[model samples]
Target: MQTTLRRPVALSGIGLHTGRPARVTISPAAAELGIWFHRTDVKAADPYIAARWDGVEQVPLCTRLVNEDGVSVSTVEHLMAALAGCGVHNAMIEVTGPEIPILDGSAAAFAQAILGAGVRRLDTPVRALRVCRPVEVAGPGGALARIEPAEGLSIAFEIDFADAAIGRQRLSLDMGNGAFVRELCDSRTFCRAADIDRMRAAGLALGGTLDNAVVVEGDRVLSPGGLRHSDEPVRHKMLDALGDLALAGAPLLGAYTGRRAGHALTNGLLRALFATPGAVEWVECDAECQRRLPGMGVRLADLAAVA
Candidate 1:
């Protein structure tokens, strides 16, 4: 069965790059609506942006979606991961600003909020994008992403950096058994300290601070309290890939492998998957497939320790 929120869930915080305060409400939508965002602050023309790969307009530091009228919603990946990981099939998300809140730089807060607000099943059946063949996209160096047919949604991620503290890390996990909630929810976005100046020069990263993101310097972690996981950077990358892939407009039943990939590469992978004929097909998921999704058997307290 498909699902949506029983009641609207609200979240408020500062946008990571825009540095603007914003509030967002995620309300239940009728079955088949998928996830869409409305810019409540935009008083003119169209104020909505469908949260899909086709709606994506930018992928520099985060995923940004723009409507036909050129109105945009920025930094939507974390909230997206929260919705997808929670098995939310339909939602009406309204934000009072241009960007969604950064929220501890992870999807944990959003996950906790949704679990608290609760979910209700809809009468409509759940739909998922099932990969039918191997699809891949590549970038300079070794950055790449690939998807292949699989029985369940799984992620294989590998990241390497010159920093000794984050040299090389790899993780592969089947998303069943609340693994997303228990394992990947709290890994925060990270950046190299050397990039801060360049980002500021480009008039970005205005809201980044030591409190919300992990800042790394050479081989040392500049973020206070260090990492929640020894391989947190790579885990965060996987979390991002899941979020970006959620733009497929439904749950995906496939195996995703990301090798040193970021937002752009992940988005490209989705484009390639959809552009290639017979690469993907929509399937009405059976109970068995549904049971193996990211949030199958998830509990609010699954990540209580991390929370």
Candidate 2:
């Protein structure tokens, strides 16, 4: 069955890159509406933007969606992941600024709030994109993202950083049965201390602070409290990938593997998947198939594992 939030949920914080304060409200939409963003601040141009692969505009450091009218929203990965991982099939997201607030640098808050507000099952059956063949995309520095056939959504990610604090780390998960909420939602975005100055010089990460993100200098973690997980950086990467994959416009039944891949590479993989003939097919999910999807069995109790 399709699902939507039972009631509206609202959040407010500062954008990680724009550094502007914004408020976002997630409201339920009719079945098949999918996810959409309405920029309340835009008065002259079109305020609506569909959250889909073709709408994506490749940009450094974040996932952004631009509509035909050039209206855009940035850094939407976490919130998107929360909605997808919570089995939300349709929603209307209203934002007061260009970028989604980087709340605690993780999707935990969003997931918790959604679960608390409750998910209502719709009359329509759910549809999912099933990968029929492997589709891969490669980027500079040997980065790669691929999706292949799988019984359910799964992710395997590997990341290597020269910083001793976040060297090489890899993890693979089935992603079903509340795994995202329990294992990945609380993992915060991380960065190397040395790169912070460069990002600031480029006018990015302006709202970043030790409180919202994990900052590492050499072997030390500069954040007030330590990491939620030892391999938090890699886990956060997987979280981002899940959010990016949600842009496929439906739940995906496939295995995703990322090798040092970032936002652009993931979005490229989606484009490749759809553009390649016989790479994917949409099918109405059966009862058994729906049970294997991410967030199918998620409940409010799942919040106990999140932080």
The TM-scores of all predictions, comma-separated, are: 0.98, 0.99
Model 1 / residue 158 / CA error / Å: 1.0
Best by TM-score: 2
Candidate 2 residue-wise lDDT at 111: 97
User: Candidate 2, which segments miss by more than 4 Å at Cα?
Assistant: none
What does candidate 2's lDDT look like per residue over 14-36, in tens digits?
99999999999999999999999
Residue 137 of model 1: what lDDT? 92
Worst 10 residues of 2 by lDDT: 298-307
lDDT values of the candidates?
Answer: 0.90, 0.95
| RMSD list, candidates in order | 0.9, 0.6
Where model 1 places Cα greater than 4 Å from the true spot, the runs are none
